[model samples]
Target: MVLEKLSKLIAEHKDVDPAGITLETTLESLGLDSLEVVEIIMEFEEETGVAIEVNEKLKTVGDVVKLIGECE
Candidate 1:
């Protein structure tokens, strides 16, 4: 459920196809810079009402999923 919502958010923000994103997809590969990533994270937090700590460890979609799981 988290992955689905996250993928949609990312796709909408980047104007990309959500179907192309997966757990293995890296943020860098999607052409997302650090500022864009932080904006996405902030938006996600607002939508989900979950606080996510931004860290250097976040590299892939899966990493974010894990972080969300831990936050929840």
Candidate 2:
């Protein structure tokens, strides 16, 4: 569920190919700046109704997925 939602979000917001998204994918490699990540997090929280504490250490897509799981 997390992967699906996150992939869709990235595809829509970042113009990324959802099929290219993988757990190891880094946000920076996707050309996402810090502000963009913040916006994505905000949108994610709004959509999931679950607030996420954006961690600076979250460097990979997998990290964010783990975060969502931990938060839930």
Candidate 3:
């Protein structure tokens, strides 16, 4: 569920196909800029009502999935 939501948000902001995005996908591969990433993070926080610290170690979609899971 989280992946679907996150992918949809990313796809909305980026030009890539959302169907191609997976947990293993890297944000850089999608050509997303820092501002886009920050927007997505804000959307996640809004939807989940959880404040997620933007971590430098978060590089993959799977990392975000894990973070959401931890917050819940």
In terms of TM-score, which candidate is strongest? 1
How much lDDT does candidate 2 score?
A: 0.86
Predictions in order: lDDT = 0.89, 0.86, 0.83
Deviation of model 2 at 7, angstroms: 1.0
TM-score of 2: 0.91
Candidate 1 similarity to native, TM-score? 0.93
Q: Name the runs in model 2 displaced over 4 angstroms.
A: none
Native-referenced Cα lDDT, model 1: 0.89
Tens-digit lDDT string for candidate 1 (11-46):
988999988999999999988888888888889999
Q: Across residues 8-68, which tens digit of lDDT does each residue of candidate 2 receive?
A: 8888987878989999999889888877877887888999899888878878889889988
Residues 48-70, candidate 3, lDDT per residue (tens digit)?
79887776777888887787777
lDDT of 1 at 71: 90
Write down the worst ten-residue block by lDDT for model 2: 32-41
